[model samples]
Target: EAAIGIDDSFYRVGGDSISAIRLLVLCREAGFELRISDLNNTSTIRSQAARALSDDVISAPGTTTQYAPFDSFDEETVQRLKDNVVPGIGLSWDSISDVAPATPLQRGLISETLRSDGGDAYVTWKITSFGSDMDAERLRRSLVQLVGSRSIMRTRFALDPILGVVQVVLKEQVGEELVPAVEYCTSASEVKARATAVSQDQRWGRPQTSPLHIQIISAQGEATSMVWFSHHALHDGWSFSVMEQEWRQLYDADGEKPISTIGVDVPFTNVSRYLAGRDNEDDLNFWKTYLADAEPVRLASGSTSGPPPPDANAQKTITHTTKCDLSSVARACAVPPSTVFLFALATALGLFADSDDISFGLILSGRTLPVDDIARVIGPCINTAICRVRLQQTQSAATALQQLQADLDEINERG
Candidate 1:
């Protein structure tokens, strides 16, 4: 029925991966074993219907007699349903209780906060574009609406009087200055210097404030650069990317887009709730055994100590970028480009550390849970996994790559 006339394209009419999953659930309940891959490849109703009836369709694994129907809802709708939700029933469309568990990552952040000496960690992204029409006032309006609509954008911390643990709190309304903080500089160098200063000097306003901020630099009137600053406690790399994409969409549309389209997001508060209730005994055991005898990473300077205590009042960062044929490396290693990049990164760090035995933390997306529309739950939603790779003096590069691949797969599967 959603197809209207069979020729309609599912995606052209606002159908997305979430809707496709919902359709799959509905069809499965009706005794149709449809392949999700087939649905993704073909957008029209006729093709999907035909594919559904054909032998090419494969049944979804782990069949059950009962399946939730709202599983088909887009990320936004699912998240909206979670806000002020009732407890106990779990992932339903009807109104329910609103208690959520704090996630493991949130717990760690809370621990850091309790220590009181925790330094700030913020992710910064700067975009410079030319020959474009971007209205500052319109962008400001979009930013304001964006902050008001998402709970994570306005989330803050408070001490739970009874438990003594820091509690995540969502405000009913946030009225932060939405206009991008403007800076004027005569040259590009000054612009960069001023932006860095803002990123370093700005804080998330002492516990009871939003962790996200933005600044717009109008440099020389020929180039406009926007710097997005977000505290790591509030967002991860994935969340920042999502926000940037939406920001561009809003700027391009002159803020005419509906809040429903641009602003529906999973609240970090819910993530904290869900994480607080996870059972990770097995995962803990695995890590303990795997890295029982691993030594601390050593640098070429023969110092294994971490970077000098971060200057609380200043920001220091060093970034280097060089491009190469990553796909070629991926092909040689028989792994995806992402894995290849990690392998290369570990190797480079191994050289810097002056040791063949390397161990470092890898960030996971934390979306592989039982929660509905987990991908849309926008907060930190980031978990760290330990990556350990042992290199041999005479081992072939291909062999080392294969070993790294095996280690990564094990960590992922167990985590």
Candidate 2:
């Protein structure tokens, strides 16, 4: 008889609903009566195997059920959904400030991007009730209403073809309900303060490309919430924080009028326009000169896992985060914080690549320029800059920082 434990290899180990039904059918064919519910109750493969053995039945190896691979929506279907559905936008903030509402053109651009991208967003939370009296439905409703009122919380859908403008709509549901709240003895004030802090921390450094995720959980009868903003392609950290404050205010007010409307208008279109006008020759030269004799380094073992095989719709993504202390950063070539950050990031990538010929992408904020002002509205305003680093045997961290600082200074000056 097979042992039963968490590590046991069961046919339904990671099976979804459909696979569960098929497993039941196969068990019946093997002269062991089983139901889908039985599999749910006995989640482990070992447990099921033990049950089968006790039933005095031997099952064929090939008869074990396998989960069907997930199918992704095709580009055409995704495009259609983009044309029809509005997507959620996550923003961030450095500090709270007020600005004008999104212009019609700005809104349109955001809508178009989301549609093409298929705007599926999520937020998770843990809820705790302070008093013995707690209403799950009421709390849920409050959260819904809070997100519904904000312009940022409203999903943005595209309206125009050429301009790709977006229109806003409130989301109907916030996704699945997780576990119920755990009871504890925490003051509401302490809980709220902690939630606010979490909200701030959850803001993304790069807020345009990734989707926003909010996580909430209850601790000691206090509710804690963590809000995640999408990548730099859609919004920024500053804008996301503004949205969080609004959500919290609305939640605490029990759906009262918002405290105030303050936002920033950063010129994303202008940045795109500026980058488009730049001479490709200079950028190309920068890459060539920096990486001419360098060989491409393979950072991760699977870094060269070339594009997925033909007709393989499965998608894969790799995320890496590296940090350097302030002292090390300051000491590196005596560069500023920004330069240190860029240099360290480049160095990390170079180390990961383990080769000298690798090219990596970095995101830069367009709001760095003075003319751009659209700060309150959520949209993609970051530009991608590719750098080719030459990892020579004799290159030191300070040398790399000096080289990067020079390259960055050139880019900024030219811009």
Candidate 3:
């Protein structure tokens, strides 16, 4: 056994969940039975190396992949993916006076929409036999403590005419009691199946209002929980997926206190600062031209009613899902899933609008902070951009894809 360099400080070399899976596969190929949790416990490269050496596990060198860090152009792409985050001005609010004084992050969330329709945001989980050694109260306390310590689970709002300022409010537990709901197995297959179903249902049934709600219900004697959130406005699909992942991690930790460094370092407040510093004249001009002389299409088929008024507060929604094997498409295009998804969405929106004048909003991950160490903070880290696709007489999907890639390249380059 050889002694490898062991650094006292832990550092993550930018490996996400997918990368962690790849690492696990590589370790297995090298005859080492390593799990994803192993990577979490040994976050630093040096630490992981030491673990492999200590176990006398001769593993092959893992392939390294570098990801582009967050930046302005990437910010624009993220804004396009999100539904809110208008340019130049802060969230377009109907009545700021009626809005209660909220934390900066909460204000940003509320201001994006017109009205505040307080709704329920609760999630549920079922615990099978609380492992003869498991204490229900201890688990509950651990969950509460985890929620209190994490800002992503907290509420963020703004106050007064303070354009860029934000305030954050931690969410409190409304009730704590393990109730019987449904029974499921504790096997990995069963747990993942249940979690995926819950995730899908929540994704499809998501609402569009404010005062975000989350609920978790655990069935008696079942190690599964049904988790649900009130609306999609407070958080996007990706956000919910992330929350589920972290919750599972915490649960597996068995009420053991988590490391303080596991918390999110970059809050959405920095996004506000980024927007405030930029001259949004171009973004405003793009939107002005995009919406000019355009009318909102009636959402449902066979509706005779005209489009709703153009008030910022007026509520409107259109849901359309494009059926395509995204993973296969990404492989063919040699681009990340995000790039492919955004391109398809942008193209579909442009085609549906019946004009080249189309602009969509997206959310960005703003982790480039001088003081922040982790980049997983919640709040609205999003930006907006116009994906102007000129329709030709006979445009093929390949051509559209090429054009989309070029547009993304330009947007990213400029950012």
Candidate 4:
């Protein structure tokens, strides 16, 4: 939708910092890589669209004639492989042992696990390009290589009984069960439905074990479809897309491991450790003061003019979209498009609540500081900040937007 106009600026059309990151991910999924800054510099639609198209052409997946099959591992072999351990990849108990505390995010997941029912939070990717030469065994090997190479892919959470802490441990290698691939000769729709069902079924599996799976589907009597599923805790949208591209590269590599230039100076584990040590007093105070008296605009209350519906929970939402000149609005208001949208949302909420003050949580990309190769790190990298907007009944739109921008700027600075 943001690529329609050749002269349009991404920021001017409501693209914020997070949006820039998402655009880069989209480019990566389209078989290309683009820096967030590149999108910022080349804000015009023509430039970005052209670069994306060209990159897709250059990075197109190549056809393969020979590969491994799906039934490469037997029960005994897979069990032995999982029993093996890496020397220095997990918790240590030496005199100089450095204890790695769980980050707040991981702790949150731990709390969820204590609950009776945890949600299925995972991502799935369906692949259609499959040649007859590409067998399950070959795909299994590529997946094994992928898991061994990426730290996040190999990570698992283990509770340290002595320390009373759940520390992340990297397995030496994943077993066949972890990376199982089976042939399913079915239609595309059936394959997708089955894959989704399987992915959701394993959402609550132990994190100490590999939370990834691959299902091979042969559509139209040809073995040409595959589905990849992984737990969301292992990575975000960006990291997942990168992993997808890397898997493709490994599959295409002719009996050789692809050279990995996507170096990570600061791994996800460091970020977790840093967050554990970093002080959040100021952020806490900001949120406390910000939301002290702010009330959420409740859309449902005792204001019904007709009979109650058959099932209140069976509600459906309809979205209407139209192309508006957002660039013009940005220029007129002297604020970014994101701010414009935020102000509009706040205004709508104010009307809904019959008040002019509102507060809500705005999720932000967690990488505020410049961590080397942070973008490439595969893990949960999102944080939520308090967004409080107070507008007068007679306040102009531009004025309200400016005030909102100021509030966000202060929060960013504090964070």
Candidate 5:
């Protein structure tokens, strides 16, 4: 939950830089556009709201701008994608919207899924139940309208022989491409079996499928439930929140009617292109030098730091779980509970690895690009950057926490 007050601290109330972006989206959806800069300056609701745009000024620039095709791929291969590959993937050429280069994380994930056959680590599932008043046809049409309007929903990844990985967009997918047939189940066993099928669906790992899938089921004397599971590429939590608001409003407005009039935001391709523009030698060189001296972490006892040495796999079993509140310690150390855990983890790793120097990756929300509603525009906006730390083996815990926080501040500032 977020802190609610005129002078409340965002971090003190469980907010961080990353989640602040998600907060920005939530605030904007409520008819006031929140600016990230204002939140960074003063994380109080009164101050931020004073700076936020009112509903009158906040315009929904429905995504109608036709983006210029990204020209990074070979023209011939692109033509082949338009001519042959598209039809093979069950898309009509008329519905082809925009073809663009895959985001770095998209490429990494698509390649990984190909390497590890049928890997679905990023698949996320969510279910919503509706009462007996649920209009299945109205909901289905609303879904079609939603999918047709968003570029991310239409995205599908393809591997090129020479042009590398690219994302193909379909203008619209109607009917069963998204909203499949409703299943009627009268017993609990049938619902359990359906849930299992959703979990094991073959499309989760396949790049050719739409990034999103939906299913609605009705049970006797029970509320109708709609299942939404997507590869992370389409529906990151922030994106889903915004979409859910729109979907619910659409469902509530019309009954047994097609939802043709749809609202939109900035297209995902615009953000992708903006991000690609920043893919330069300077950032690459910065990270290369930042982690140049670091080696992969190896736990003295734990296997999570890295792949266990060739001999460590399947060697033993160690299972332990302990939970303790760190609020008091965090206060004493003048740092958040998260930082306290970071310090504690590093100390344990230092003792286990017997090394003074340690390095680990710090994940960035990857929404730093200067695009309109960048915080709200979501499509695989996750990045892993490394943080290296040298332990002062004899230092006090408070001193270590302060130093670590300073180092992290420097990373957040410069990186």
Candidate 6:
């Protein structure tokens, strides 16, 4: 209910690491470049601007990688994966360029969507407003470049008999049609609604088809809004920041060259391979011990016996006013506002379930993987984690907050 001033703090206003990526992208596009760590340290717009753009010190972005398929595996291994994956779908061996493992989360989402058959769960839409800066044709070219730069945008997900879920990356020549041609409308609102309709349509419910749909709505030959329809598996909050940064550069930084000339430094497929190949023995064991005695906090809606209920098709948004100064509370506890919010969430859930012991699902960025330049790495690189908290009757409020803070710190370090 409050407007954020330039001097306002991001986290204090409820920003997180993932949103910080988006903030940085918007800043760079507006002609001021900043690092993620800058927001982690200060988060206020003026301080960030002063420090980042001093003496026109915009740090140059890293170079993008060219089209090199499946460098992690040997030529023979990649070819074999392609061979096994081809028969599962309708693609031919010659049309397949390479193969990579799907991100664990993407695999789960695909499975759930397939099981449910149809719903708005995995389908996502993103709209970004643009002025008449780039002409219609140029904007269309940028969309093409966007598809070509990232393999996930042009790839298909297939369940391989031996390898489980795998991403079948098609040859560039074959995947060129991944991005839909630009569509027009008299008004920006009409285009946005059209894009939403496209997202809600179940024609592309299966994962085998291309998961990307785009509409560059132009009114009177002037670009207005861009609608990006994608399966949740293809992108995350982090991916949106990465994609927008590259997309803006398509017509700005590399305007004179062909879109095909550019590529991502770390393709989504490469990140997936790294994530899938990691040894999770320690992680698994830690979670097993951590949640061994934790009881899930669920709504006490009487009938708890039969198989779990199906997902409710309806959606609702609830808003509440806490009437508490969270910044003061965080300062008293010697923790960040986010930590305060975490404890608040735990306390609220415990109260709802009428249980002191509670366990909840938390979404982690998975950006902590030991990969190089992970902060800038793209894709749905997210992990679902269980956060367990036991609030003892004897403990003081401050004591509980400190304990939760310690647990969160450990989780961040481990991830």
- The model with the greatest lDDT is 6
Question: Tens-digit lDDT track for model 4 on 41-95?
Answer: 2357787668766664345322211112112234553333234321222323221
lDDT (tens digit, per residue) of candidate 2 on 5-103: 564333223343334434555555555655433433224666766877787555453343221111123456444434443232331221111111233
| Top-down TM-score ranking | 6, 5, 4, 1, 3, 2
- Estimate, for each residue in 138-221, the C-alpha lDDT of model 3 and write its tens digit: 445555555554444433343323333233233333112211133344554565466555554433221222233332333334
Candidate 1, residues 6-111, lDDT tens digits: the string is: 7755433544334554665566545566433333213478877776676544455434222222332356644543442311112232322122344556556655
- Choose 2 or 3, whichever is better by lDDT: 2
The parts of candidate 3 lying over 4 Å away from their true place are 1-135, 156-158, 161-165, 169-234, 260-265, 282-375, 382-386, 393-400, 409-415
Candidate 6 overall lDDT versus native = 0.67
lDDT of 6 by residue, 1-415 (tens): 5898898766556665556545655555454555434543244778776776566646445322323556656767666666666666788777766777787788888887777746446877767667656465577677687776666777778886656778877765543466556677787567667666665566553577757767666664454666667888888887787777777778665565544444544567767776666687887777677778776667664235577557645556889865988777765655567767878888887777777887887777766554445566667877877778897889987778767766764565444
How far residue 245's Cα lies from its native spot in candidate 5, in Å, is 3.9
Candidate 6: how many backbone clashes? 0
Q: Looking at candidate 1, what is the lDDT of residue 301?
A: 54
The Cα RMSD of model 1 versus the native structure comes to: 12.2
- Give the TM-scores of the predictions, in the order they appear: 0.57, 0.38, 0.44, 0.64, 0.70, 0.71
Ranking of models by lDDT: 6, 5, 4, 1, 2, 3
Q: How does model 4 fare in lDDT?
A: 0.57
Could you say which candidate leads in TM-score? Answer: 6
Task: Indicate the worst ten consecutive residues by lDDT in candidate 5.
Answer: 57-66
Tell me the whole-model lDDT of each prediction, alpha carbons only.
0.55, 0.42, 0.42, 0.57, 0.64, 0.67
1 or 3: which has the higher TM-score? 1
Better of 4 and 5 by lDDT: 5
**Candidate 4 residue-wise lDDT at 106:** 61
Candidate 5 lDDT over 214-234, as tens digits, reads 887766555567778777666
Please count the clashing residue pairs in each candidate, in the order shown: 15, 55, 44, 7, 0, 0
Candidate 3, residue 237: the lDDT equals 43
Question: RMSD in angstroms, all models?
Answer: 12.2, 27.3, 16.0, 11.8, 6.9, 8.8
